[model samples]
Each structure stands twice: as C-alpha cells, then as structure tokens.
Target: MSKKQEPGAAGRATIRDVASAAKTGKTSVSRYLNGEKHLLSDDLKERIGRAISLLDYQPSQMARSLKSGQTRLVGLILADITNPYSVEVMRGVEAACRQEGLTLLVCNTNNELDQEKHYLQLLSSYRVDGIVVNAVGMREAAISTLQQANLPMVLIDRKVADFACDVIALNNVEATQMMTDHLLQNGFEALLFVTEPATVNTRLDRLRTFLQRMQQSPQCIAEQGEIELSNSQGLETLLRDFVARHPDKHKAVMCVNGALTLQVARAMRRLDMTWGPDIGLSGFDELVWADLAGVGITTFKQPTYDMGVAAIGQLVMRIQGNTEPVKDIEFSGELIARASTAAR
Candidate 1:
C-alpha cells in the first residue's frame, strides 16, 4: 500500500501541485486553466483535467486577475450628481451593469476638470475595465493616459472636440431649433435666450441654433433681436426693460436648461410679470417643479434614464473588445407645450 496521507498536513493544491501530479510542467497547466488550450497537447490537456478533478484544486481569482490584467469592474464619473439628468443616467448605467455582471463605481467631479482627471487616474490605477465620463470638459492628456493603458471609455451627456470615443448625448441643436420655431409660429416676436454660459457644447449648440433661427427671420432679427443673458440680475433687468419697452409685442423667453429656467421663473414672479398674459415662457430639461409653479412652463423633456442606460451599454461593449470605431448616439428631447406658451 502507498504511504498514508496526513489529514491536516494536506494543504491547498496549487498550479504546481496539479502539474506535478499530472506529470507535466507548470506552464502547460497555467495555459490550460487560463483557456489558452492551443499551447497544450491533447494528452497533456486530458492529464491536467484529471489532475484538477482528483486534487479538487481551485484557482485564486486575485492571482488570475493579476495575470490576465482584467478587473471586470466599471467606473462612472459624473459632472454633478445633484442634477436630475445625471441621476437618471446613473439609474440606466446601474441597470445595464447589473445585467452584464459588472460592478459600477461612481465618482462625482462636480463639473471640475481637475477632479475628473484625478478620478480617471485613480480608476485606472485600480484596474477598472472601463469608465463613463459625463463631465463638462475633457483633457487630452487624461484621455491619452487611458488609451495608453488600453482601457475602454465612453462619454455621457457631453462630447470632446478631438477625442474619439463613444458618446451618448442630447440633440441640443434640433431641440433648440424646434423650440424657437414653436415660439415664432405662436406669434411671440420678442424672444430672449437665457443660459448659464456658452462654454460647453450643449450650451453653445443651443445658443447657435437659436441665433441661426432668429437670423433667418427678418421680423425676429431686428436690432433688439435676441437678448442673451448670463446672470439672474442681468436676465431680470433685460426682461423687465424689454416688457416695459415692448408692451405691444408679445414677449416670450426661452431658457437653456433647468437651472436657467428656474431663474427665469423667479425673475418673472419677482418682477410681477404674469406668465400667460404678460409673457410666454419655455425651457429645457423639464424639472420636477416645472408644472407645480402655477404657470405651466412649456419645456423640452430629455430622456435622462435612457441616456444613462445607453452610455453603460456602449462602455460595456467596449470592455468586451468590440472596438470597431468611435460612435456618437443622440437622444431626442420631447416637446411639452403648456399654458406658459399658450396662444392668447
């Protein structure tokens, strides 16, 4: 009989023990277990399989990940988590990750490029499979670093001018054009475009589209044509002055996003300007209190949840080695006509 095996002395079986038991080299066992079967002979493969079964060997996931260089984890970097758009997008991303058996780690950059870069480097160091960025701007060096590491990434709700990556964003130009056309057809001659700043692509696109639409129409492109206001006081003063001067002309205002829309609404109320009778209002990114503000502000509703889900899907595909070329996906905004822009 063979020597009796000790009970407690038998430790966990490693790749070396498995190879020795199968009368093969450690490299063959490593290759076979890692699914690199082309390097092993059929006889050796059978022996390794038998040895693995007899020893009840289990591979260490940590060691396997170190060798394969894959974390099966995803990182999501949002510009601002407080924004409803970001929150909705995150919901979709989480859902997609759950379906794909991947983990999601979210970081809020608060719309800061430096913070975004820091998170990007941190995530890369942690060996995340990919990242989804929804920040305001992009830095070339930050993007190049990820590329150099062969890490997959996708942009959500924003786009970089030169960086070639998958992007999921809104159709800002079309939405703004549609909003402008609606206001024009409804007989609102004096229109104001209120926004935060024309820095990001979304803001710039909407402003350009609105200006272009106004330029084409001789009646709307007068000397006092489109009033572009940046701050709350400036916007309020401009609107108050416009109303005071052009009481005969139907006054209508368009806001770029939800935050600007809130400011516009407050200005209207503070200046004692009625919505339905005194002025007409419409804005983008329909907020929760949009309808509850007494005056129904007609606005464009973005598909926030769907955007998040699509961003995650694209990143997941990239992580899976589906690198054909960069793709840009745009989601259309829905036009909600309300009492604010009601025809009198």
Candidate 2:
C-alpha cells in the first residue's frame, strides 16, 4: 500500500524542481536564489524567473537561512543599559541595523559576570548572526563559548585583550591624559583619581593614563594619591578621607564615569565641600546632572552614539562574510570644561 502525499509536498517547488523546470542545474538555481545574480546569463535568469512564477513557489526564509547558517540578527549585551554611554551606543546600533535591514536584540547584564554569561548563552541559543558585548572583566570562558559557536562578536567600551573580536572603544587613555593635562595646566595641583574598580578595561585604562600623566609632574608624583572604590559606601569613605587629608590643599578630583560623578557630588554635599572654590572636579563621562549639579562638573564627553553606530556597522560587516581579522575602533572623547574645574 502506497502512502498518500502531504498537501504541500508535491505542490511546493524546491530548488531541484525549479532547476528541472528551468532546464538548468540545481546549483544555478540555488546561487540565483541566494542573490548571486552575477552567475546567471540573461536567458537562464528568464527561465528561472518563469519557472518560479509558474510554480508559485514561496521560499522558506527560515529553511534557507538555516541552510546558510545565519539569522541576520545582531545581539547587544550591555553592562548597564541605564548608563548614558550604553544608551547612546544602542541608538547608533539601532540606526545601523535599520539601514542594513537586520534585527537587533539588546540584553542588559547589570555588570554581573554570571548574568552576562547567561545572556550570551541565550543569544547563542537564539542563533543570532552576531553579538556586541559591553562587558566587565575578561572572562576566557565566555569568549571561548562565543568563539566555539563561530559567532561574530564585537566588544564595545570594554576590551578583552586575549579575545579575538572587533572592539569599539573610546580613547580612554588619551582622553584621561588630556583631562589630567588640562587640570594641571589650569594650576590645580592637588589631584585625585577616583574610580569604581580596576577590573573593567575602561576603568583600568583611564586610571593608568591618569597615573601616567600625573607622574610627569613632580607635584602629583610626590602626593601619590589615588582612590579606588566599589560602591557608594567606599565612595563616601574616600571622600571623607579626601576632606580630612587635604584640608589645606585645593582639591581637584577626577571621577571615571557618571555614576562616580553622582557619588562624588553627594559626597561633597555630605562633607560640606564647596564645588568651584574649595573642591575642583572633573568626570570621565557627562551626566544629566553635569550641568545642574550644585557645581557643574567638567567632563570628558564620549561619542556614545557614534560608538553604537560603529559597533552595529561592524556586526553587519561580519554577517556579510567580511572575514578580515578583528579590529579596534577608538573615538576621541571631547573635554567639556565647566565651572567645576575653574581655576582658583
């Protein structure tokens, strides 16, 4: 007894059926369907077109994509989407994705390694074409997982030196150096570099650059002052120490990012330190309060939007079979000098 055929089985035209109807090889039909139009002659193109129209064939995008091993979707894993940097980068990524006709999936890890790893695993399971990770610390396991899966990944605002992937970063070192130099040139001698932790690449690079630049001047070298804090409690402790230790010296502190800046502002209020005259300050990234904070903070303005745009562009390129080795793109951070760092 012969089994009955399914309703669409015989009616649906595969590449083989199209090729047979067009009097051409299956390879030619496959290539043409995949957008390799250059391989087909005018006559062959017409025959294939006629065959497809006659069969009323509708290609299964999912099946074709699976066969080609791609989904045309890019995933972005951010440390914290609340950060202005992350928000700006996301904007750029969305714009680029829209232009390329690709989809974007964003995941916020809140700076947790385990959460980041979980999101990475989820994105991989979804079979996304590529990923843009703005992660903290270097997790060899995470990098290895993505590499083993053959996913094209890019790092944004953070770098894992050992990981082989494109990086979209701000010129953290250069920007810090420039900000420190400006502080020095403006005659604010007592300098302190305050940051969250040295684990992330951006923080480490900024701290290193600030230290290196300050070392060039004998005054800063002699002081040897640096403050590293993890949370708001640590920030409070550091600020109290600063107030107690530098009662006489005019204080000029540099914060790594906006979160740090907010903490510093709160710390200043608690310590009763005046902004412009008594305590001079500058921050790495600008915040919503940078302008309105009791004392406006001078800050290094990163092109967060541009970084996002470039990251998406890179992911799209990788998806398009650009097998070129990974690259690191760095954008300059602008120094927006404000009242906080005004000279005495």
Candidate 3:
C-alpha cells in the first residue's frame, strides 16, 4: 500500500526546491542556510533570501548541524525547575548561551530517575553539542551509558557516584561549616539539621559536614531530622518533636537548602514559635523571601547564576576540545546574618 502524506511534509520546501527557485545549486542553498552567506556574492545571497521568503522555506537546523558537526545546541536537565535555585541557575546558563549564539534545550527531571533517563536519550538523539545536568543521582547506570558516548557533559550542583566528570557546585562543606559556626556563636547549644532527604550529592555533603562540625564542637549538641517533602503535616510534626526533644538547650534549626528553610520556617510559624529568643533558624540558600520571614532568616547566599554560567563554560570548553584532567569547581557561599540568628 502507498503511504499517506504527513500533515506538513506534503507542502514542505526542501533545499533542492529553494536552490531551484533561486537558480542556484543545492550546495549553495545549504551553504546559505548554514550562515556561509559571506562566501557567496551579494546577488546570489539576495536570490537565495528571496527564494527562501517566497517559498516559506524553513531549513532543518538538525540536518545542517549534523553536516557541520556542531549543533550549537546544549541540553540542560534540572532536578526541579520550580526551585528558585534552579531558576537562577537556568537564567545564567541561558544568558551565557545567548551571548555565544547557541540554543538551549531545557528539561525538568523532577527528581525522577526514569524521566531523567528518558530525557538523556531524547537529548542524545537530537545531537546536542553538550549537556549540563543538575542530576537527581538516581540513574547512574543510564548516565554511564551516555558517558560512554563521549558527549561533553557537565554535572551542576549534584554528581553521580564514581562517574568522573566536570562538576560545578557550591562549596557545601565550607558553607555548612560556616552556618554551623554562626549558630554556635549565637549561643545555640542544640542544633538540629533539617533536610528533605540525603539522596543527592549536595544534600549528603551538607548533612555530613553538619554532623562532623557538630561532633567536633563537643559543647554543642547535634540532631538531624529528615522531612518527607510530599507530606506537609509530617514536617510540622518533625519540628515539634525536635523542639520537645531539646527543651533544655537553646536550639537552632538548620535547613539543608532554601526549600527546607521555607518549610521549616512555616512550620515554626504554625507552631506559634518565634525565631529570636525561643528558637533560631538558619540554612543554605539566600532566597528572596528569607528576609521577609520572621526577624529575617539568616542564610547562605550561593552564587547560583555564576555557577550556572561556569557549568556551561566548562561544557563549552570540553566541546571546544579541552581534554585536560576532570575538574570540580566549588563556588563559596556568603553567610548573611539577620535577626533570626541574633544572640540571646
């Protein structure tokens, strides 16, 4: 049986059609589409432009990119774009790509390994020049397969275990230590570290550093709590239990990131607890809403946009043939103090 014509393909204008209309060869049309107009005379350029306009011809970027061996396209996969950190990072990547005259294919994994794997395969099929991922770290096997393809890749904010690649993230250890020290200096004897789960690299690093710092202090008591993000009631319950457990000491709740900080702050408000004398709160992420929270939340401000730009830079360097040793770039976080962590 004869196949039916696809909806748009029947009237689509091909390079041959454009060349015929322009009274030129297909090679010349292809060159024009690939931004080699300078190689052709002004008269030929005008002819091609007129033909393209007349025919409503849309050149296949993928086909031209394949022939040229550079798509000028980059894939970006984020764990969750709804997070402010992810949004800031994406802005940086987008700005850098615009400056470089490149296009970005952005995907949100939502921390689902299966979705991430699927997007990786899809992006690979598109033949992107490189990929920058703020991974959920659950699909290392699929990522391993991509690594074998030798596509230039950069891991942003999170890294896969044992999968060596270029990584750009905040200095988690130093940032956690700084927050820990701030709480201790503010006369918080008991510190409770709150997080969603220690599933990703950044979370694990911050949690481990917090634990280690608390242990080293000897004078300050340390406790850790994990909140199931899907359950809001559970978070409030967890905070209430934490406060009950540390009734004797001046306690501070240290959130793992901005999201957790907001969660914890809300829970505290719901429980009729205040930030100043009753309980102090501080965490990573210098979110905009942090200051508006009760007595202004103390926070660690990460260079999110810069980190995103830096991640793309590393990926571009690899795409441009940088084959040196794998490097992990860590940007430092600045601690912003406010009434939240004020000494009693």
Q: How high is the CA lDDT of each candidate model?
A: 0.81, 0.80, 0.87
Q: What TM-score does candidate 1 reach?
A: 0.78
Best by lDDT: 3
Best-matching candidate per TM-score: 3
Flag regions of model 2 displaced more than 4 Å: 1-61, 221-230
TM-score of each: 0.78, 0.80, 0.86
Question: 1 or 3, which is superior by TM-score?
Answer: 3
**lDDT tens digits, residue span 1-344, model 3:** 12222224567878887787789998898788777888999999998888888777877887768678998999999999999999999999999999888899999999788888888888888888999999877456776658756689999999888887899999999999999999888789988888887888888899999999988889888988887777779988887888898889998898998888888888888999998768998988899988887689899999999998998889999999999999899999799999989998
Candidate 3: RMSD to truth:
5.1
lDDT of 1 by residue, 23-88 (tens): 989999999988799888899999888888877788887787787777768999998898777888
- Alpha-carbon deviation at 86 in model 1, angstroms: 0.7
Query: Who is ahead in lDDT, 1 or 2?
Result: 1
Regarding TM-score, does 2 or 3 come out ahead?
3
lDDT of 2: 0.80
Count of backbone clashes, every candidate in sequence: 0, 0, 0
Clashing pairs in model 1, backbone N/Cα/C closer than 3 A: none
Spell out the clash pairs found in candidate 2.
Answer: none
Score candidate 2 by TM-score against the native: 0.80
